[model samples]
Target: MNTRELETVWAPRMLSVLRIVTALIFLAHGSQKLLGFPASDGMPDPFTMGWIAGVLELFGGALLVAGLFTRPVAFVLSGQMAVAYFIAHLPQSFFPALNGGDAAILYCFVFLYLVFAGPGPWSVDATRRQRSA
Candidate 1:
């Protein structure tokens, strides 16, 4: 296949993989908090901060997985992670190496990327656009 054709095929395939993987990870984390599974110290309590995070993760992750409303959902999820970093992770220490701040920071950036770049051409939003056009 020509380079252009290869690009078209590979890009969408990669994006689909990214969408599913990120969504699953987010869903698992959110479910753990929502269901109170494993019972970690950092896990948020229901009807509180945990509840908010759980909703964001669960719904946002679902949207991401389906490639629907990806940009807005990713933006919200990014904001949520930023808040979590500042409120929970940052106060502990400046060094992520010492604490668990690095993971939160990483999540923040990843969600931010998704917010700006969106779910790409493999998303449901893209399909909807194609249909409308």
Candidate 2:
């Protein structure tokens, strides 16, 4: 394939890959917190802000994994990441590395990007849109 054509075909696929991988990782975070499948700091008590955030991560991460309601869900996820960084990370140090906030920072920006870009090919949203047209 020519360079431009290759780029055209690959770009959307890259987005789908990124969305899927990121969602899975985020879901693991949720699972660790809520389900206690993986080791983590600790599970929050029910109805606490931490518990609520874990709930959001589980459901929202699932939606992102499915590429359903990509924009809105990603937007909310992005906001959650931002809040998490500021509240949990920013207090510890000036740099993300010092504060152990790199994941939060990365997730915040990645989800923010997804909010603007929408789900790419291989997504349920894209399939639904295609079917409607």
Candidate 3:
């Protein structure tokens, strides 16, 4: 196939994969907060920070997975990670492996990337565009 045709065909597929992967990661984090799957000591209850994190992760991740308002969702998630890093991780140290700092930094960057790149051509937004055209 020609380069243009290949781009049209594969680009969306690649984006779909990235979206799914990122969504799953977010979902897992939400689940941890909501369900206490990993049994974290910080699981918040009744207007606690953990509860807020759970809600954001669950809803944001769902929206991202569906490719609905992905940029906004990713932007929010990125902010969440930024807060987490500064409040919880950075005071400990800058090294991710030293504490949870690394993970928080990584998540922040991933969310930022999603915010800029968006859900790509395979998303619900893309479908909406197709229908409108």
Candidate 4:
């Protein structure tokens, strides 16, 4: 295929891939926070805000990876990332690099993007949409 044709063919698939990869990384963050793998010194205590974020990250991220309920879940995850950035990083410094809020900020924006973009062609959402149509 030519460049434009190839782009059209692959763009939605690439979005799905991006969503999956992002979700997997978010899930890993949840795992590290909740399961304490890799020996984190700062694992949040149970029932705390950090733990709660971890729970959302775990389950919501799983949903994202699966591309189920993509819009709502992505919206929620976006909010969570916003909250996480404010609570954890904003206090340290204004800049993301200095405050260590870059990941949270990035997640926030990425989730927001997913909220607008939906689940793309390869997702459960897309499959459901097709069935309904």
Best-matching candidate per lDDT: 2
The sequence of per-residue lDDT tens digits that candidate 1 reaches over residues 12-65 is 788677877888788777877776554645666667987888888887888888
User: Worst 10-residue stretch by lDDT in candidate 1?
Assistant: 36-45
Error of 3 at 103 (Å): 2.4
After superposition, candidate 1 runs with Cα above 4 Å error: 1-6, 37-44
Model 2 C-alpha lDDT per residue in residues 99-126, reported as the tens digit of each score: 9999999999999999998889989999
TM-scores, each model vs. reference: 0.84, 0.95, 0.84, 0.93
Give a tens-digit lDDT track for model 3, residues 6-122.
788987688778887888788788878887776666577857877898989888888888899988888888999899988888788767788677767877888888888778887
Evaluation by TM-score, superior candidate among 3 and 4:
4
- 68: Cα error in model 2, Å: 0.3
Error of 1 at 60 (Å): 1.1
Backbone clashes in model 2, listed as residue pairs: none
Candidate 2's C-alpha runs over 4 A off are: none
User: Tell me, what's the RMSD of every candidate?
Assistant: 2.4, 1.1, 2.3, 1.3
- Candidate models: Cα lDDT each: 0.81, 0.93, 0.83, 0.93
Candidate 3 positional error at 13, Å: 2.1
Clashes of each: 0, 0, 1, 0
Query: How far in Å is the alpha carbon of 129 misplaced in model 4?
Result: 1.3
Cα deviation of 116 in candidate 1 (Å)?
1.8
